[model samples]
Target: ERHRDMRRASSSLLGLAPRLLSGPRLCSRPLPLLAFARASQQRSGDAALALGEIRVADATGSLGVMTPKQALALAAERKLHLVEVAPNASPPVWKLLATLPVVEKRPEPPKIEEM
Candidate 1:
């Protein structure tokens, strides 16, 4: 029907295709895809250096707080990378990341039972 086609077109345009095809949704309607696309996305690696002042933390506990520049210098001295762990905090929290080697393990073949 013309009405159904129009509804589908409008829903798809508003990023509501999932709700239309799916039976029911637990959460409220999703925001438009464009809203997310336009928002600022999280950066990585050296980008943490631009986060101004940040709090440094580790497995042992909080390592105290410092400016990004100082923290980066310390991280370099320790042979680690400054990674933003929690960006929503007051000044955001950064962690020291150390590179580790990756190991791949393959599974052994199953044994065959003789008749």
Candidate 2:
């Protein structure tokens, strides 16, 4: 009937095929994408310098291979931290880094009244 045909035609948008609506819905539904709402993306720093031998960079920009314990001891004697700078080189290079001193707030001096 013409009424049935008009109802079918009115249900679908103009120029859009009726088969598209009757088929499985894809655009109306969300895709299978994951949301990292509760996920943690941060990673802790891992020191490549261990007990094994590694190349260290001195003040003169020269490289020398030494055990991590020796380098660490040398850094400790100098009051510094041995940090690995180059990890992709033929031999990893280490550099000495100075740690910042923590500053604390001190109580104000007692007020003195002079006559």
Candidate 3:
């Protein structure tokens, strides 16, 4: 019985695949390619911050439709800027951090015995 039900469900989903894969319905509707490109650039910029480099990132929320400037001011205090952390969020969130001034710890010099 369970196997029969599984097959039925799978077939139902398969039938809908073509419609789901088809392009958008509106011929004149502007695609979000430009927005996606900008977001990609923003993500690359965020990578620099993750590497401890100084940078400013202006984040967008709600499908990149709304931007709140207050976030930028907060980031500036830390010498950083808001950057998108996850683009998949319904309203993406950003973080502020220094990108250029990553302080890498140096290894201590090895001690040598006097000859």
Candidate 4:
């Protein structure tokens, strides 16, 4: 008898599952929670500028386990060193400067052909 009652209760619960999964029903319009979340997390001018250089680095294999010295060595030929931009991250990303090899001569600008 208890088993039968339990089955009935389970079936009733299952019936309500559809309505629960349907999400919030508000008239005919549904508010976008995702947009609200994004807007709330949006930063102001200063904060945005500060975070512009920040990046998340994912370390997976042996290469991900590179030491700071090794990273510096790898980046030596170029310009900027691999710095830990985000210490909180498992493996921080390194910012490479656009103007690398400062001592090296910059490429010459292309000359426009006159028609």
When sorted by TM-score, best at the front, the candidate numbers are 1, 2, 3, 4
lDDT of 4: 0.41
What TM-score do all the candidates reach, one by one?
A: 0.47, 0.41, 0.31, 0.27
| RMSD in Å for all candidates | 9.3, 20.4, 16.3, 17.8
Itemize residue pairs with steric clashes in candidate 2.
none
Please give the clash total of every predicted structure, in order.
0, 0, 5, 0
Across 28-102, the per-residue lDDT of candidate 4 in tens digits comes to: 333334321233433322232333234422233233444455454544655544433333455544443333222
CA deviation > 4 Å runs, candidate 4: 1-63, 99-115
TM-score of 4: 0.27
Write the residue-wise lDDT of candidate 3 on 74-107 in tens digits: 5555566455555555455555546532234689
lDDT of 2 by residue, 9-35 (tens): 765645655554454447653233221
> Relative to the true structure, how large is the alpha-carbon lDDT of every model?
0.66, 0.57, 0.45, 0.41
Local error of candidate 4 at residue 29 (angstroms): 22
TM-score-wise, the better of 1 and 2 is: 1
- The lDDT, on a scale of 0 to 1, for candidate 2 is 0.57
On lDDT, the candidate that comes out on top is 1
Pairs of colliding residues, candidate 3: 52-99, 53-99, 53-100, 54-99, 54-100
Q: Kindly indicate the candidate among 2 and 3 with the higher lDDT.
A: 2
lDDT of 1 at 46: 71
